[model samples]
Target: MTAPAPETEPTPPPGRRERKKQATREALLDAAFRLFASKGYEATTVEEIAEAVDVSTRTFFRYFASKEDVALTSQEEQFYAVLDAFRRRPPEESALTAMRHAGTLLIEALEVDGLADERMSRFDCLMRLTEESPALRAGSMERTRRKNDEMTRAIAERMGADPERDLRPRMFAAMASTAFMVAADAYRMGVCGFGSFSEAVDAAFEVLEKGFAEY
Candidate 1:
């Protein structure tokens, strides 16, 4: 008797469609960044970005709610990644030490991923855009505020303090964030040059460890 015919492989269902959507979303982000850097964020229209990525205006909206969202997507992930690292610090470490370690790890990862240059480039564009556009400025502030909240919770957890009752965690996190931003700004402005982003972060943490009393 002839063997029964082998069943044909089943086709993938709707989940494959979701992955395609994600790829399209990332492509849109890449296209948007390129346009914003070259043409200026304010002058770059949604239609232009959609066209650059070979998608319709309606399709762009399906991925990003607005142009501002494009500037913020990767930054949000970076902030959360750092906060998560801080939250896992050893109990023996001081809050400041924990933050320094977390920051170092984050910088290392950025460098490893070859995102340091890209991040600086995007940040430069974002700074310029925010300075010129009130709407973009508001979006930037909102992103910072959200990151601050996440850092506060991470600090509180690391210190074994109640996030609701203790103000120290929030204060420390705010100060740490401020220090990091100042260092980042210095690097961007060419005030300090280092071999790698991690080196810059290490130098900044050293300065912080030395205390701002000298400043």
Candidate 2:
């Protein structure tokens, strides 16, 4: 009798493969941030980051267009999270109110991710990278402006107003983003002494809602 054929291993499903790819991408981002923090962004190379993750330099480029893209991952993540939260806010809520709630929810979600401190540290690292590299700074600002425009579109949709003709949505999106950044900068600069970052954000929103007339 012929010997029974040996069983062959089955290929993993597409979902499993996709999940592995996502895990690899996140690992690369984490390693990139750590390296950028310790060695400085401009001082770090793509090959070094790839080696840290046991991946080829080609793999790194596959996930991120450049070192600057990897360095800005944290900001990009927060931008999307805030935008998503803003989109999910109650339909009847005012634009400012939705933004305030979205900001709070975004921070809370970050804390829940169990990497609040790490994320803040990475953000600080990104800030340093921005200062040290003109290319990174320009890229960061341009990306931020794009995010603001996207947020403007979201605000316009939520308000059922014309994105082109109605200026309130554009203004609200830009001002809200600026307020959040100001609070974050204050926290980073130690000007927000004795207060949590969330508190700083809350205060910024409060000032905005109050029309800033008292200041």
Candidate 3:
């Protein structure tokens, strides 16, 4: 007997809504960064960015709550990705070891498609804006605090640390994050000067590896 004809799978509907949302978000981010770099963060208005992006002011609110949110909002996904990796590290791995691995993965992920350079440039601009505007600085600090909390929790979980009993993982996470940030910041500064950005990052990591006792 002949087998019954196979059924064809249904195709998914076109992702028009999702694609449009992504395009709109990118447009907003691009416009905001341009305006912030050229006009300075404090001088740039939400309406101005919305106008530049050809979006309504209400649409801007749909994506970000305020001007400061624009900068911090973009990093939310990256921050969580790293945190999730950290939390899922093997229980036997030392906090420092896990952090080193996670940091390397995070850096590698950022290096795709000449994104490292683009990200560094944007980061430097954001740093300058943060320094120039008190509101931006405060917003940046809050974002950093949130990231640190997430990292600490991830490290604690990986090390099987009890919230009330162990502090080492928390400390390790803090130090590791500081080292990574210092490396990135130094790279940014070096790039602004005459040094190679990648070389500066390597040097910073080398110093971190040598430990503070050798300093």
lDDT of 3: 0.71
Off by over 4 Å in 2: 1-23, 192-195
| Candidate 3 wrongly placed segments (more than 4 Å) | 1-16, 191-215
lDDT of predicted model 1? 0.77
TM-score of each: 0.80, 0.83, 0.78
Ranking of candidates on TM-score, top first: 2, 1, 3
Error of 3 at 172 (Å): 1.5
Q: Clashes in candidate 2: how many?
A: 0
**Model 2 error, position 78 (Å):** 0.9
1-215 per-residue lDDT for model 3 (tens digits): 01121234675865999889988987898889999999999899999999998889999999889988887676666567666655555656666655555555555656755566766767778878888999888988888887887777777776678746788766776777677677777676554352544445445555665678965
Top candidate on lDDT is 2
- In the order shown, the candidates' Cα RMSDs to the true structure are 11.1, 11.8, 9.2
In candidate 1, what are the lDDT values of residues 35-135, reduced to their tens digit?
88788878989899899989899999988888888877766766777776666666677888777777777777778988788877777777777787788
Q: CA lDDT of each candidate? A: 0.77, 0.82, 0.71
lDDT of 1 at 200: 67
